[model samples]
Target: MKLGILFSGQGAQKAGMGADLYAALPAYRETIDQASAILGYDLQAVANDEAKITQTAYAQPAILAMSNAIINALGDVLPTPVAGLGLSLGEYSALTASGVMDFNQAVAIIKDRGIYMQTVGEANPGKMVAVMGDDQALIESVLAALQAAGKRVYPANYNTFAQLVIGGVAADVDAAVEALTDAGIQRMVELPVSGAFHTPLLKDAALQLTTRLAGETFKATQYPVYSNTTGSVFTADTLFETLTKQIISPTYFAQALQKMLDDGVDTLIEVGPSDTLIKFAKKIAPKDVKRYAITDVDSFNAVRDLLLAEGKEA
Candidate 1:
């Protein structure tokens, strides 16, 4: 079975995500230490802080460092990843894993990206909500109605077959949620993000990031890295443009996974904290394919042993 690497995004982060890995593995410790030095703060300390970890500025780089450290620490035991895919901000980590960039470059830019997004968020003061347990057409109509009414709400992420992350101006988002609730929608849990990510409201952040991304050097990829904006393997030449557009466009994660599946990625492995991407993968992945996640020490050992065993057999 071919193995595909997955990276988790902002909301998937939690307190103490990579601390165990750092304590147990020298590689992890070095990787985290390297990232911390570049970031001008202790990466683990920032992630461990309850309040800091949730803030966009801290969370983005924290998750990137944690995820990249785990992948880097795994070394040759990982059996040469077949492809890489990440949710939103995780895409940068995926690129680092694929050799498009190094860990230091990724964390530095990711921190700046987060700060820029937060800046735009502060200026706009928007909101995002997960629209759950509703028909896709119905949800689309709801979003379309909001647009027609000039309320500014839109579907920011297409996470699963049924779940959508909606983003808009705070009051417009609130009004949209209220309307959906009154129209028999059962769930619309507001995300605790600082801005309306992956929506037009973040256009300023996207523009700022475009200039930042242009300065960074990117190498050719070792394997396919799917784009959240186009939901397919992105052109390396246009990488910066694709990533910039991703900030203001809806992330077609469901479609991205489908494209990976179509290309024969059978065993999906989540390389960061929590199973948020795994949960979304399960919703769209075929029943026959397998799924794994490497989060803490135990999970790391489990997937490591399995990969080592698979390696021995081959």
Candidate 2:
């Protein structure tokens, strides 16, 4: 019953998230309070503010704080995972979970990261679109053709074999949508994000984040924490580079999931505000692998009891 955990990223945030847990659990309240102190404002207020919560600057830290609060509420009753991975901004949560970075420091760094990314996005507007299909070759071919034609579009996220996200200049992204539709790939959804994240357009943001991270200290992880940029585990040597490049590099999330599967993680739990990662896991993981999404009180209680029961049975 080896467990692997997935932390929620930026896009998973929603207004009024964590309110139930904050009200019902002492540990959860304590964690959020701690985050609020570090952040210099009330975290709950930001979470309830729809307009502010959607903005990257607040969203990143808020999501991280929420995810960590969920974990704190569960405490040691939850099994210690063999490994963990996060999508984009959630990677900092993974670092915190694994003991590689202090929670306070991680929240602080993410706040700056969010602000830098937002600044870049506003200065150089770009777009991201979720593409759905199974043909990797065809997808790459279209992207290559677009690049050859001088469009800035690039694959931003390899979410699964069935879904890939493309991002770049707004005009180029719109053109890619047309090209993809013409190529008989019609399923696409425009993401509600402020920047062309994981594309070259975020180079400036990455550079700014790099300078910010230079001052932080990282410790050895208690368990392996996978990298979204490299599709593998992070080491002391590659930590800084992988985290910085992740800002502008396409996330190899499917590959990271596969690596965790190969490493014998049969029970996967997603801890965050949304169940999106679990949805992606369903498409990739084998039918036998158990998956759970723990977002709110009901889901958390259900997963906790089930896991404890299963542990007793084992």
Report the lDDT tens digits of candidate 2 across residue range 1-314. 89999999889999998888888889998989999998999998899898999999999999999888888888877788989989998889998989999889998998899999999998989999999999967877998999999999999999998899999999999999999999999799999989899999989999999999998889999999999899999999999989989999999888999999999999999998998988899999999999998888999999889887977988
- Candidate 1: stretches off by over 4 Å: none
- TM-score per candidate: 0.96, 0.98
lDDT of 2: 0.91
Q: All models: lDDT?
A: 0.88, 0.91
RMSD to the hidden true structure, all candidates = 1.3, 1.0
Pick the lDDT winner: 2
For 186-284, candidate 1 gives per-residue lDDT tens digits of 987898788899999989999999999877788999899998888888677779789989989999888898888888888999988788899899888
lDDT of 1 at 71: 87
TM-score for model 2?
0.98
